[model samples]
Target: MSDKITFTLHELVSELDAQADELLKARHGITGSQFIALATLADVEPTDITDLARCLGVTKAAVSKRVPSLVKAGWVTTTHPPGQGRRVLLELTDSARDLVERAGRDLDEQFAALVDHPDASGIDLSALNDHLNTLTAIFRQKGPRA
Candidate 1:
């Protein structure tokens, strides 16, 4: 690929991420990483550090490092799994559940607003989703080693 094309994509992604971070920070007073972790926990069953890392596309060590901050905030509770040696299962505190719900609602509204473009044309969302599914399958098979 040409350098210009690659740089354009990178710039676009960086701009998108920066905008998203600003929105979440202004609305929830939380960083995007924290929002992602809370949202993942809200949607999935209580998960261990390893599971959370996979869900967030981060490393287990990174998740482990964040656990203490969450614990201090009373937003998460940890439990040691028997026979798992040192694995800690993370669960959202009840208060965290409420926060997560509120944040999720806000994010949904924000995203809906962005996608509610009056000039949007010829955008088949279902087809886009199907294409994403194909891409995901290809990536899975390639195993990040391609």
Candidate 2:
């Protein structure tokens, strides 16, 4: 393990993302990117593509590209609200809500197993989560770095 905290955080995030992708693929037939987009939409539905892209820390074009597959898979639907002047809003379908809930339960189980393991003994998960959340807030406040 590297002594650099930033490097370790990067590596940990990458590994976690890969594992999540594999798990989601096996259980739900969705990629991690797709899952994230869906989850974000669940948190903030009736949002425009630009807002979704900002939430995902990606480009509007990237979110736009993913919309077709999600629509085809019956996970999302887009609509134009009155007076929006061509602005498109996205929302999760009923099926997508069910899928997100189930997937969230599965991920919770996986996380519980990991935290309950002997190797994780003595770790204060609540504190860790709080610190991570604080860090995330700080980063988000700062926006993207050059």
Task: List the candidate 2 regions with Cα displacement exceeding 4 Å.
Answer: 144-146
| Model 1, TM vs. native | 0.76
User: What lDDT tens digits, residue by residue, belong to model 2 across residues 25-120?
Assistant: 999998888888999999999899999999998999999999999999999999999998978999999999999999978976887788898988
Can you tell me which runs of candidate 1 are displaced by over 4 Å?
1-13, 124-130
Best lDDT among the predictions, by candidate number: 2
lDDT of model 1 at residue 1? 30
Name the weakest run of 10 consecutive residues (lDDT summed) in model 2. Answer: 104-113
Evaluate model 1: give its lDDT: 0.81
Note the Cα lDDT for every prediction shown.
Answer: 0.81, 0.91
How close is every model to the real structure, measured as TM-score?
A: 0.76, 0.93
